[model samples]
Target: MQIVTRLIAMTRARKLQRQFQLIERSIVALPVRTRSRLAIMTLREVGQASKCEFPHLYGTAPEQRYMPWGQGTEIGFSRAQSDNAEVALRGIALWLAVAYHETKESPYTSLQPQHRQLLRVLRELRDAGAERDAMAQWMRSGAAA
Candidate 1:
């Protein structure tokens, strides 16, 4: 039985390796510009997805509070309050996507300082509050233009 189980695991591993190889080949088959475009689109989508708030955090109370024990500062954020933090993170993600496509031939290349700064800002916003207003502001500005 043990030998049979080992053989099954080995077979599964081989299948996974083949699947990975196919995916790698598919990515490599695309032209550089096409790949860059895909990266840009993917980044945009991911940024949007990140903005989706966990609805469980929702409540109709005028001032709802939840304490995240580790942080020690009782987080007292409403949907309106967190809007900016979300916007900031999404904006940074969008810029990072642009940087990935425009700056280097490969996405694996070292990030520029500006891109790093954007990442830092995103992290700061994430830590500051959950409303993620920054992400909302970015989306609003884009729509306005």
Candidate 2:
């Protein structure tokens, strides 16, 4: 019984790891500007669903709150409300997408300070090696146009 339970847990972990890897690869393949836009849109959608007032945080508002990644124009959560894991995960993914989009010079270069921080957080959410490998592979593929 113990072995069976351990095997199930390991299988689930592997499945989740694969899912995260796929997400990293897909985001890396997206155009930089498109990924930035998607991050902004995801934040807006998540905020609206969570009932966070965003009169100044959506749709080209000059004072809108945004993540530090990209041009710093993407909307972001104002406060850490609710302990929902899904919302947190979406926010992390959005940040990762934006960072990955910006650092397109090379897999090992051109990452700004903010991008590094965002990548660190993303790696914390999943496997850092897997995320890096996906990004590297995408860069080599030249499909980020």
What C-alpha lDDT does candidate 1 achieve relative to the native structure?
A: 0.36
lDDT of 1 by residue, 26-127 (tens): 434545444444345435544543443422122213244241111101121111123464433333333333332222232222323333543453343343
Residue-by-residue lDDT tens digits, candidate 2, 102-133: 34232322234444645554444345344555
- Count of backbone collisions in candidate 1: 20
lDDT assessment of candidate 2:
0.42
The candidate that wins on lDDT is: 2
lDDT of each: 0.36, 0.42
Error of 1 at 124 (Å): 27
Output the TM-score of candidate 1: 0.25
